[model samples]
Target: MDDAANPLRIPPQMSVYADKHNLFHLLQRMLTGLLIDQPEDPISYLVRLLQAADVPKIMLLGPPAVGKHSAAKKLSAELGAVHVTTDSLLEDQSELSAEARQYALTHQEIPAELLIQLIKRRLNSVDCVDKGWVMEGVPQTFLQALRLQQAGVIPQHVVMLEAPDDVLLERARGRLVDPLTADVYHQTFLWPADDAVAQRLEKRRDLPEEQRLADLQRYRREVTALTSAYQHVLRVVNSDQPITDVYQQVAAFVKTRRYYRTPRILLLGPPGSGKSHQARQLSEKYKMVDVSCGRLLRAAAADGSAVGDEVQPYLDGGTPVPDPLVLKVLDKRLSRLDCCSRGWILHGFPRDLEQVRSLQESQHRPNRVYFLEVTDDVCLERITLRATDPVTGERFHVVTRPAPNSEVHKRLRTRPEDGVDTVTQELRLYRKHTAALQSVYPDAVHIDADQDFHSVFEALESRLTAD
Candidate 1:
């Protein structure tokens, strides 16, 4: 393999992976036969010609502002590969065509179809595909990575960046963004002395420290799932190290791409309850993807693909997509996220005797299964008040005025399964199945979801929170 084909750059936390030499630089030299031209640059490039191997691509995963984006971009510049960030992708109007627009409007997400299309577009670009690229914040989940791979967008390597909780919290707190201009300024380094604009800028005091901690913890949880999925293809890096040391480690990890691991997960729940909401909230909180079966099935249909054939029937039937089919679809979805080292939220599937048995049989079980115990009544009420988007078919509140024309109470009608009478029937079914399900897990908590959402969440939170 020609070293010129692949690039190696030092990242911020290289000391943790200390072996004989910097992995990125060593690999770069081995491949290209040329020493990195500029070691001082944040991004270093090494390409020599053992000469014909495809330059392996690398992804830097870490919580926001952990320098994942900064490191990847620097490396890209040094390596001469196009650097892609989530913000860049988000702002690309050309990529946000009618389909993508509708998806954005409806789902509150960059739909899988849109993502596949975008990856394809990026892969075909003269800069990205031909010379190779360094990407950050793209495949945030097992499913997203799988979508890219299934679409043939596999990365040659992934760098999993981890930091201590204290350092992460400090980083989060020190970070500041100009809300209006979307400009970021780190208090310690970017702030200008005696600059009126900087002085006038205020920290988001409304967002309490606890919230920041919550956000960081949530990110860790999500990333844990993603890491699991792509464990085999990922190289773990501790980003808490000094910037120069970090880069050296990242470069070194890139050199040993084949020695990485892929990640996996097993999340279970029912829909219209708190499953999807919690899944997403937790995923964002953890930095993992919430892979909902319903969402996947819809994406398949929208993409006009064969997966739709099996999924469309369940949707049309107005019934829950079966556990077997859900798992099957998700099994496909899992293959997309090149790595699940970050973890994911498995929403709405794997319910009842068959689903559980099927899940166990497949041997793809969750590290810990959480049975969200929402009463049928509560689930029904929530669905009734939430309006769904016609395009993405996502649910949201149709904020309206209060009292008569004053508006505030108008809402999207509930699904028939969520109607009062249906709820009663469902509750009866749930009661009957609870024993059987609990029998499978002697320790599963039977939460009283009859209480407020916050209260129920508090119960779950206590379990995960350190005493």
Candidate 2:
């Protein structure tokens, strides 16, 4: 094989023995270093070395509510791989037997043979074959693993998530599923703050505590044995820590599997909180395009594009753009950014809870959201002091970037909305609309925008670059 095509050439000594007992012993020796140290970096050096030879086909295995599916979805996003959940596949089966459908809806495992068939069909699809895939909720038993291997659908790596039973139970209790969208929501963590969606979601019926414990016990017994058989390709991740920390561990492994993807970042803040400024700086530093929805809308309206024509009147009259138009422009701009390969920083969209839901529904959600927090007084003060250059459209603070001379000062322009009363009203409106977003995106990183620009940038950079 060409060196470019096969980056990490597998040594001839590495072999899969036909005898099960001998195969287990071979895997045990190969994985002895990983199983013993259990280092903070879960992805072993050998695993990284092997992955360079092939596209990653990852399998996530864990007990119920331990976040296996969530981690798989995230890894898929980061790697640009297709996410294949066995539960989703079962739900999508048009001719699924009523018995199978009933079993899928409950907190119990579907039959291993049935699940193996579903997984086999999905793995053969063009999407999975072309883009590679990260799958979860399958191969919970040794039989399923054997069947998968026999069908030539073995995973390149298996991530086994470990979490305390109490944490899993608490997560399971709050789990809600949208039967229509097949979207899972957690009451405590992932549920929408908006009353409309929250009220409409069907809470999943919880199994009795005794039965739930029994289910966990059974899952542990089966999965432990199954994973032991696949120890050569296994990586164990601790899931009881903060979600970001867990994501970091998984992402480290994924990075070794594929080329790095550009980071998709979203910035949220009230007007005058300097979100645009921070976004621009971060984008430049990170080599990502800065895509401001408000800027895109204005440019489109000025250019008389189809969307601009519809939105021109609103912009000319200083009216808030309708959600549909905003989303339309956003989608168009994002499409043009080549963000899947090039990365972008999104700003001035998702201003309210409804927009958040709409963004999620549209499937263009950001990988991470940064909420710039600033007090109203500081915001108002900054707006009052802000001046613009009509020719360049550059904003300047009176104290920080004041014009050098009277002749230069004469070219500065003040926005109509820069008055104290106008700014105060705008700030009030911002608070009213965005108050719920804090609750909706509770996991968004809160950056203290009240600090100096350098300090704020340092904090943001540290979070992005940390491990």
Candidate 3:
């Protein structure tokens, strides 16, 4: 490819590194900001943008009397983020449309379009954009949330405050607002420390029993939609608890970064360590493509593709496919949309140091590597005792999983490779390269395959989702 066509002509490994570190995402975000702002000093704008990457972009979402305002204020103070809301945006009508300005004065509820417009303007401001912001309870409806997202007002963390209906009602009844500072206080839950502040505290009267109930109902109905919109970043907090406890939980969650990971998983272990079985389980559950290297080679050869033709002779001769050919088949298989989007869990390849290096250099390097650890004795027994029902292609173990009937048992066939001698050789080869493989992926999850199938799966699942 020419420089004009493939500008930087970055090495394949560079693409892999960028993907792993989310560098492309960062670049896209910076470019998008540049185009949107059209800043004269692009370099400085990008520097500010990079500096703002970790700044908190938070949303406090909850029903009435959930203490969202209080939480937003506390978080804003802690993180030095701008506390943004409908009231804050409406404070200065200079940026608002004439209709929104009029509504800011007279209307109890701003229309979705006007509210979204105001929020966009406020969040896009230099202060909010560079310093980050905490949006406190302005988007009371799903439509408002959707519109805000469409306008690029995405929150890095969505603190979904939840409380029982009774608790909310009681909170609303006890609500008090300070005239001077506009701080919220409650009769049982919270109170002002200073006598002067208590003396000036005014009961919140606008939210009557009927209004509170209606608001709660509306929130309950719209909360599901909000969750769907921000599910990835949303963390539910039991706001019925003490405000301090709630803040701690919300703070811990907000401090963590969110990653949009595309799961490229690799399973490695000796024969009968259940790599293929576990790969299938993960693939089925997580909707990732199960790329069994041996099976893929067979399919490729059957498909009559160029790669298949090159590797077919080796397959026919029962010899190992060359590293280049295996990598070729893998590159073609893993680059497909299904693997790229839905992700993939591959096994039965990259069995040595050279293969590992080749894979690391490839564009689709595995982010999640797992070694299913099983004892040699267990591996030998598991492989030697297992037989396949040729008619149904169902695997059966002689000791653990017997054939369903006499006919099936009689028809069950064991592969020549599964013989004790062949499995022993394979295990020996695996052991020889195991240390180097471990060195390559020191952080790879080590799953104990000696346990039951379900236990091994749970271990893998925990690691897969704990992120």
Candidate 4:
């Protein structure tokens, strides 16, 4: 092995294990604690962090009568997250700042600054932090949203329930509340199944229609700004559906796995699916490392180190290199700073579940995985019929792209690995592993590689910009 190949060679499998068990997130939180407190007893501080409860921070936002209350209540009960609302924060008038108190006493809207102060205090409460919190219908204005963000009241998930104004109006008209339980119900839509609870439902006092319309219009005016402020974490859901259906959608969105934030991209598909071309384009534009496994292995082999010596025989014989050697090379390349900081586009490796499992342990596991799909026949034609110009080292395909002139094409040579027999074998292996590989990356973007290279690259580029 070259001493310079890798200095701090962490085993890749350990990274896989850590990711599987969420140890990466745990360490992240631990580091955050160390940074925040700068505690003298660092180990003890870490131990305390391990024992701290991870409470869910959630926000439910919507227009009046848009089912935010019902959704928030269910989510709070299920996740054991404390339910906080503007009303809950204001229940104790004495806790309010004098400025806010004056507005409340006068039945007038409080200014954003004073309103956020009260919210900030409650959100930072011991209960809210320890048990997690789900806030309902606070910061209904853009300024209030900004004030909460300035106060660091960030939620992991922010859901906005939406419905037509007419639907909300009708629901408001039919709204009922249980005085004993304070659980809201709609007479037409959500009559209690329990006969006793149904009998006690009181028609809640309706805000005068004029006032209600005014409030709705106010919401319409501020909604675009409010949504834009939290766009990254926000999910807008239709609330006109059945309660069960609405809750399921909201719950699913809340529980979905958030992808790693870093821009590591993985490209998968059968060989000759334009992964290499797309990767090069992305690297050129984004300044990310193009970690092509085949290229790296060839480069390593030509370097004449112990690592190169071991893999050169496999390359010369056209036999598959063992997984361990492949990982050894990848672990070294992936650890480089360009890949870590500027980000990476990895293709032509991790061809099966075993490789994906090993990769899971490493922090370099891709957050964005794309699979470019093409037919087996196309793969065969693309790979087998392509010849490299030995003099210029440029590849030309007989069917798609040809050498400029016969004089220039005369020296073109096809490597043994590009032979029809070899390509057929490789395609067979890929076909066997394709399903399991896709199963591991269900969220991976699938692209149509059969199209022209420009279209394929555009599809990949559009998806990258979307993030």
**TM-score, each model?**
0.40, 0.46, 0.65, 0.56
Q: What stretches of model 2 exceed 4 Å from their correct place?
A: 1-261, 389-394, 465-467
Per-candidate count of clashing residue pairs (backbone under 3 Å): 86, 0, 0, 5
Which is better, 1 or 4, measured by TM-score?
4
Model 1 per-residue lDDT tens digits across residues 312-397: 88788887776666776666554332213344556555557777677666534454456776655556556555554444454554
The candidate that achieves the highest TM-score relative to the unseen native structure: 3
The sequence of per-residue lDDT tens digits that candidate 2 reaches over residues 180-221 is 655577878576657677777898878898988987998888
Whole-model lDDT per candidate: 0.58, 0.72, 0.83, 0.81
For model 2 the local lDDT of residue 415 reads 84
TM-score of 1: 0.40
Tens-digit per-residue lDDT, 379-447, candidate 4: 988999999998889999899999999987899999887898888888898999999998988888989
- Evaluated at residue 233, the lDDT of candidate 4 is 66
Regions of model 3 farther than 4 Å from truth: 1-12, 34-48, 95-98, 101-111, 138-142, 206-208, 257-259, 265-305, 312-324, 332-365, 368-465
lDDT of 3 by residue, 1-467 (tens): 11233233445455566667867657767776676668899998888878878878899999988999899898999999999876677677474655676765674577887888777777768898778999899678889887776665667789999999998888888889998878899979998789999999998766557877887999999998887677657788999888899999999999998755667899999999999889989887768899999999999898867677888899999999999889987877776656655678999988999999999887878888999999999999898999999999999999899998999999999999899999999999999999999999999999899999999998997677335
Model 1 poorest ten-residue lDDT run: 1-10
Best of the two (2, 3) by lDDT:
3
**lDDT value for model 2:** 0.72
Off by over 4 Å in 1: 1-273, 319-324, 380-405, 408-412, 443-467
Ranking by lDDT: 3, 4, 2, 1
